[model samples]
Target: MIRAVLFDLDDTLLRLNLTAFIARYVAGASRLLASVARTTPVALGVPYVRAFLAMDAQDREDSLTNEQLFNKTMLEACGIPLDDPVIADLMTYYEERIVPGFSSGVVAARPVPGAREAIEAVHDAGLICALATNPTFSLACDRARMGWAGVDEKDFALVSTYSNSTRCKPSTRYYQEFANQLGVRLEECLMVGNDAVRDIVRDGCGLRTAYVGHGRPRGAVWRGPMERLARELPDLVARLDEQDA
Candidate 1:
């Protein structure tokens, strides 16, 4: 029997286009950095962008935390020696200015049409719910996104953020940590999200999964039409109940 439901934030419960958010975030960071670095936004941004992309690529194969990879890549891209004071300053600026701006914007998040109702339904069914987004962001940022998604912080039994987790998603360690925190066996949890690679495929860790159909291109074990996703929550719950019998 499923005792809990875990969700992905972006493009699942929330309707914000993540790719667009990233582009806007990068642009904001570049503009902010340029103001202090005495360089054009694009000029300063180019290296950072290249480094960021490189770090993302490395993340696929490397076990380093996202922050670690980001710092190392930023230093390398800026041609600054590791542990340089300037690098520290730049990192501080990025976190203080750029990161906060991104969070603020997320506070204005849009919820999927039936997301709120679905979550309420889950709660009413006596099941626990949590947000299991990839742990690359801080809790504050995650909260901001939740706010945008029309979900209250109290709605989740646990909210996994980078600060709360040591492993990123698609990694069984990450899902395991969440399962541990909630005091639930993996078999009793259901993960619902839009990313196939990160969310659904995590079934290897033992949680059942439901694929929300609107995000990155990926094959889902089960695909439901986007418009029907929220509307079908009741039916989904019924199916789960029947399966558990």
Candidate 2:
């Protein structure tokens, strides 16, 4: 019984050449931070990368928001103090420039085939939807990526961001938290994405799931490309609806 659909942003709904995007993003982001903070570019860049990776780490010691953890960890790695304005400036740049620029030249995002229609199909069937991208990014970044996927920001019921999500993917709590947000039981939702390791791990949180292609699915109900999802989802959703009833 799937009352909601959780869609992963990158690679699932939008097509991204990961290597090319990361190379450009790191370069551009480092440059932008250097210009704004007027710091040693290489020094700032290393901590930036490390901090982002650290956020993705599954060690659940504390429940600090991603901003607090990133700021604290990044400042320590950069040999800066708690009161430094550079950290503040870096966050501002992230929200204002980073993602907008990513969607522009650094990594031009394009929609995966049949993505918009599939989402629309879910909505047409009276199911709920959310953007379940890993919350290590700012909302602006998610919105920009959504644009490339041909999805309007208004379409999602919830957009997960580091500001709100306490755990990263592969953590069952991450899936649980999103289900809680929708005021629905986890067993009544479907996590739909391409990342076999991360997105499909949502099943551990008690939700049903469908695996989009390029990911080796373990026990997902649907396994294929976005085009396949578009074709099969109407029937699949109906099955779930009837089964739940």
Candidate 3:
């Protein structure tokens, strides 16, 4: 039986224009780092962008956490030492101030239709509900985005963040890690998300996927919008569990 429901944050539970958010986020970060690094935002953005993209290259067996890898790559690219005190200040300012600021004005992050109800459905079925967003940012940033999604951190049993996760999404190890956190077999979890590549898994991780993206993608055992999921998830979960059994 499926004991947990792992929901992706950005385009799944949250109606986020991830591309736009990333662009704005980069701009904001560049502006902030420019002042500290004594360089123009345009000049600093090059290395910043490089470091950001480096986070996407997941290792099957990585020693460094996503945050650690980001810090290492960023410091190397920027010629900043690992022990630099400014590093702490930069991270603190970014997560506490800059990331929270992204919620309003241009960043348009909001809840997906019926997202809250879908979460409620998971709980009603007595399943473990986790916010399985890609762990590229701090937990504070995740919580800030959660506010935009009209969800609370308290709602989830596990909220994946850069501090806690070793890998990024689309990696089967990332999926397996969350299952491990819930103390359940990977096969006992249903990953619900809108990304065709990140949400669906064909590899032998034993995790199942229910895609809520634009089209029916390959490897998804189920497909529907959040509204349908809200109404039907309990029954659907039971059916999937029974089928597997």
Per-model TM-score on C-alpha atoms = 0.71, 0.88, 0.93
Model 3 residue 14 CA deviation (Å) reads: 1.0
Per-candidate Cα lDDT values, in order, are 0.69, 0.77, 0.83
Best by TM-score, which number? 3
**lDDT of model number 3:** 0.83
* RMSD, one per candidate, in order: 4.7, 2.6, 1.8
lDDT of 1 by residue, 1-245 (tens): 77888888887888875766666666766776566556677775667676556443523665665556655675666644324577456745565555545534543447787778767777887889898887765566676677777888799899987556656777777788889999998878878887777786533555777787655444343466445655666677678768778
Model 3: how far residue 63 lies from native, Å: 1.2
- Collision pairs in model 3: none
lDDT of 2: 0.77
- Residue-wise lDDT of candidate 3 within 195-220, one digit each (tens)? 88888777787888888989878788
Measured with C-alpha atoms, the lDDT of residue 238 in candidate 3 is 80
Kindly list the per-residue Cα lDDT of model 2 for residues 12-121, writing each as its tens digit.
99987766666665676666666655676676768878878878889868888775677678777865542367755675666566555566553657899989988988
Better structure of 1 and 2 per TM-score? 2
